[model samples]
Target: QVALRCGANDFGGTLMEENISRAAGAQYGVSLSVEEIRGIIREIGRIPKERNTLYEILE
Candidate 1:
């Protein structure tokens, strides 16, 4: 998570439908919900911006 602390705007791959990371025993591999992501962004003192699958900002 250090990467996230270092000015990473978003947590990529959190909302993946088929999560291979979970199968590999990564507890934090679950897909993140929009609300969950928003909360995490807030906790890290940043605004949560929504984006589409193509990484386009969703207004």
Candidate 2:
């Protein structure tokens, strides 16, 4: 949230699994919906974009 407001534009991957994070006991979960992510991005006054593995926009 703060990051977006501070001019961060990248939001990383949407469908990728967080297996390494989970294995390390990060409790934020592994998956998030595109809608949910977009909502957060909008809440922070940034546009949400869906991208493919090669960083091409899908939405």
Candidate 3:
């Protein structure tokens, strides 16, 4: 997760496809997409750059 923030990005979701492990519980909130993660990074005053799964620069 720290890598995501350092790369001007944010994590979207986990492969598990649920929020049960989070403090809010499974019924609270939904997962985010890549686009949403980008938006969040921007909102947090980051550049919001894209990267591949292997961490290669995309844009």
Strongest candidate by TM-score: 2
| Candidate 2, 1-59: lDDT as tens digits | 88677877765533555565566698866666768878988896677776787989885
Model 1 backbone overlap count: 0
lDDT of 2: 0.70
Q: How many angstroms is residue 41 displaced in model 3 relative to the true structure, after the best TM-score fit?
A: 1.6
Local accuracy by lDDT, each model? 0.70, 0.70, 0.60
Itemize residue pairs with steric clashes in candidate 3. none
> Which stretches of candidate 3 lie above 4 Å from their native place?
1-24
RMSD of each: 3.2, 2.9, 4.9
Each model's TM-score?
0.55, 0.59, 0.43
Which should have the higher TM-score, number 1 or number 2? 2
lDDT of 3 by residue, 1-59 (tens): 45554762334345446554465565565667868866766676667665567877786
What does the lDDT read for residue 25 in candidate 2?
92
TM-score order of candidates, top first: 2, 1, 3
Q: Which ten residues in a row have the lowest lDDT in candidate 2?
A: 11-20
lDDT (Cα, 0-100) at 1 in candidate 1 = 37
Model 1 lDDT per residue over 3-49, tens place: 56886665555555646677778886566667876787788777778
